[model samples]
Target chain A: MRLERRASVPPILYVAAPLAAVMVALAISGALIALAGASVPEAYRRMAIGAFGSRLAITETLTRATPLILTGLAAAVAFRARLWNIGAEGQFYIAALATAALGGAASAGGLLPGPLLIPFLMICGAAVGAMLLLAPLALRLRFGVDEVVVTLLLNFVVLLFVSMMIDGPLRDRMAFGWPQSVRVSPEAALPKLWQGTRLHVGLLVAVAMSVVVWIIQSRTAFGLEAKAAGFNPRAAAFAGVPIPKVLVGVACLSGGLAGLAGAIEVMGVKGYVTTDLSPGFGYAGIVVAMLAALNPIGVVAASLFVAATFVGVDGMSRALKVPSFIADVTVALSLLCVLVALTLVTYRIRR
Target chain B: MSETLDILASASLWAAVLRIATPLLFGVLGALLCERSGVLNLGIEGIMTFGAMIAWLTVFKTGDLWFGLAAALACGALFGLLHGGLTVVLGLSQHVAGLGVTLLGSSLSYYLYRLAIPVSGSPPTITPFQPLKIPLLSDIPLLGEALFSQTAPTYLAILLTLAVAYALAKTPLGLAIRLVGENPHAAEAQGLDPIRLRIGVVAFGSALMALGGAFLTTAAFNSFFPTMVQGRGWVCIALVVFASWMPLRALGGALLFAFFDAFQLRLQHVTGKAAPYQLFLMIPYLMSIAALVVFARRAKVPQALMQPYRRGER
Candidate 1:
């Protein structure tokens, strides 16, 4: 058998490939469910219901999807430029901490009026996130160091740094020694989008940012340059595109989006920062970005799907006695299958 | 300042350093072998997690430690095959596919562990490897107790480091592997199949990596827990660059890292409450990044590293 690259792929294959991959992934997970002595169909039914059956369920999934969408966009933008920003987790933490610190100060000192505090904190958070990522990007550009390893290692370092801070300087004294930051001032908290629900306006912000990123990637001159740079750096350089500038732009956008995710999560959901504020949101963002094929708009859909799976799996695990890790397994398997599916879309196997 | 010197003077501190280095030693060699074959096994973190779980579970159930290690090696190879299938055979992006493998391997480990063992206050434990003291060698004052009093796997790790260094430098098979990595087309010209060689090397290297994880469960600690691998695999990846893809230097790098880690742990105790212990925990990762900045420019990388090899494509 030989694999041959297709001359041209139909546009529909892009959509169809991911759908097929998800189905295949779910089937594989069903087999694992069966192995665990659970009815696969029943488990899936429970999952579906748990994620979308009730208003509360739907809202909960959407609430979880809020940060995921932003983080997914973070991964999407970086991966599009082949930047490989794997330290989204770290950026998310640092951003959240920064946002918390700012929000705390603004709330206590009336540093900013109530209406202006949210935007101010978010801008600062994004700046912090961008700076964190730029450090590694600069190292890579200057020393020929691999950003992948540096970004990954930074995740651990940042986590420990966050741990130290929350346990020391950022420690909320009223929480009986729990290592977490002081709650954001009430005036600084994000207003609820819907009454009597956990869902906040952050979901709206995430959706808006996805649209904004979509435009930047598809319509902007920088987007074209980034695409060229990623596709072939030598060709891009020959075309007189500043490769370094494009990468620096990509770094700031990617890191800023991730930082925004953290900032939103703090104001919208928890109103504070903790080391566990992100439940692998940064890593999941990579999976989401890949599953979306790195299309900014597609990230919104992919994140919702991922969020539903986690929310559904939570309920399913308690009911069926299956481990909740099944959600992670399902997501990870889908990523691998999608990579294959995308390959099949671009190439044909001939025997 | 004197306390720092006193901490280093203790024989147990040196012994702990060797113990900590054992797993990293196995890990770096495994990673080095794979990278030398032109594949980046980013799945090391998850693969190691699976290895830790499977080894401990095997020993816990079967009451045979060697069997547990064997089980881990086999499982690790299987995961390697999965990774090789994606990155080598399909010609997918190594970074993405490897990350997928990591996610799959780690979550699968946790899922299976939960299925086998019910939720409990603490995880179950097994009889870990005891220090196998050499008769005459272990009798020496400081060096003997530090080096010769390690467990069986620790000794194997040291021997394997030398073996890998020799094989990579001298053997015909090693030459073929390096040739494939440096120039697969040249290897193909010489009538060697690059794909098969890569898959084989990746599998063998991944098996060794599982042994590293097995050491963690069956030697360093008696029980398996989620997240216990704790980015050690990433550290090994960094050590590979620090080693400049050389086996002997990989050994030296792992030892140096282990020494820093062991030293920090002691320093944390000595300087209790003066600085947060988390600061000490951050040393190894920070040091890895610093080492990369220093060595990455000078490090000679395999030309075909992360490159997809097609049989006929130029």
Candidate 2:
């Protein structure tokens, strides 16, 4: 009833709201599990141990988290400039294709050593990815088009485009009509950082990019323009800031990072691109960015949280015989629950 | 010239057009109603799934196709009511609330469907409804055969387009929905409840959409599939924006999309030409992107399509 009690507040309430929402979501999910004739504690235990307990599991989780870290950053970057880039999955696939094509060429060139070749591949991947994203971003800013709808719709277009490539041009000659491209040479591969695991240099790149994003957003002038433009375009325009340029530039960075994610997955791990190289990483980026509340550092933490849920789904599915798809349901539920809870950051949550 | 004449000879191409347009027609007409009421029914995909599930379940249990179709629409109406209740009454954010409804319906449908037939070699499939051939027109040449020879809902979809076109342009109730969409406060001054109007419009729209889902399972495929709509609801959403909130225009957009899909399915059979298949597949999405690119800022969206409507206080 006391809606006017804004005079009394605590800073920690912002922190508490997210925590409370998670607890509430878990409780609701527990009720759902009960409806499904399952035990909540048993389910949680299965999910947690599956995600974080085993070394192999952690490695697998890292592999999953690698792309997320990049795509989340991709989302975070465009969102920083207020460009809604929702086609990262498409960007990722195309980037993967570019990276794979480069990898195929690089392996053929035995002249370049390991030190020079790896960076060369990554740069090519990033550049190709950036170029693809540039067109949409250009039209969006220059024409005053809403990037959200265009980028979202572009996702399907890119997927179909990739499908065409794999089906027609990229299909391996030796693989008996398979949809995957040729595997890259071992020399062109991203070296495994862990001896007995699939985890590699991509995870490090993700971590480094997080730091770079943090610096860019908090310290750089471009970042300041992004914040100004995002918070209020009219106000920023009144202050003589170039809103369109900032939006386009930010969208490129977003597309570039998404492209980079695709490249890394190809170069560091898969060594080749397939039709299903990306499994909705862009959509997951939406959830990650929203969970972070547009904070880059928050994105790092949010990506890990999402990674854990995906990992846990695998574990619970095996032990409890619950379908792995429940992971998606859980993530969706958590996102809504968390957003609703975040309302307390702005308004009072009266009993 | 003789080669060109040979290229033009095909009835299946027209058949493919009707087959593809059926669902888009059902979903887009439903979208037209909701947009007119200023409630952007973003959960059309999820509602379609719910409708398909219930309709299939009814058919599976009862074996009566008509009642099954009725049940599908009823499920859609029920969901539309819920969407109306949450956004129109509780004043929740429609995007998130609608998405929640979608996730809830889809997840629940998936889980329930799995429970009914668990761990099978293949997901259990249903026999699709029979096509209702027109009395005289089924035998007619290219135009008559393509337009009239389809499942009951295919004809129903065309009938729906006419009904929506007429209702939206000629009815007083349609004006009320429009008034609610454009300026709810002004509508209230005219002695109408914006909230009640929204509820009715959304429910009606949902029923119309649910029929689209039923059409998919019964008339098109003859069985249920998970995530079968595959973002078609969102396509319907794009159609609404692309059409700038007009019924006949929505039909045009729907048919264009259906033609793209049908054209793609046909492209795979050209004796060896493969590249165009990808281009064909990309058409609907490309059109959506092109539409938003060209008209997003200029398009006249319903004034309160996504804004939550609070009952009182300035």
- Every model's DockQ, to 2 decimals? 0.90, 0.40
Query: Superposing all C-alpha atoms, what RMSD in Å does each candidate have to the true structure?
Result: 0.9, 3.4
Q: Please report how far candidate 2 places residue B99 from its true position, in Å.
A: 5.6
| Superposed Cα deviation of residue B113, candidate 2 (Å) | 3.2
Q: Report fnat for all candidates as fractions from 0 to 1.
A: 0.90, 0.36
lDDT of 2 by residue, B1-314 (tens): 45334434566677768888778888888877888888867668778888887788788778888898999888899989978876776555565557656765676666656545567776566677776778888788886667777877787788889888888778898788889998998899999988889999999899888888888777777778787876677778777777878888888888887876766565545524735567866777777777666666777878877666664533
Span of ten consecutive residues with least summed lDDT in model 1 chain A: A170-179
lDDT of each: 0.93, 0.76
Tens digit of lDDT per residue, candidate 1, span B1-314?
89988988899999999999999998899999999999999999998999999999999999999999999999999999998888888899999998999999899999999989989999889999999999999999999999999999999999999999999999999999999999999999999999999999999888888889999999999999999999999999999999999999998999999999999999988888999989899999999999999999999999999998888887
Candidate No. with top DockQ: 1
Tens digits of lDDT, candidate 2, A1-351: 212124555878766876677677678767766666668899888888888889988888888888998898988787666676767887888888877776776677775777777777777767767776777777766665555556656777777777777676676667765588866667778889898899998899988988898898899888899989988889999998898777767876788888889888988878877776776677777667766766777877878878888888787877776666666666666666666665546545333
**Model 1 lDDT tens row, A1-351:** 657899999999999999999999999999999978998999999999999999989999999999999989999898888899999999999999988888887778887887888898888889899999999999999998899999999999999998898898888888875689988898878899888999999999999999999899889999999999899999999999999999999999999999999999999999888888999999999999999999988999999999999999999989999999999999999999999999999888877
Which pairs in model 1 have colliding backbones? none
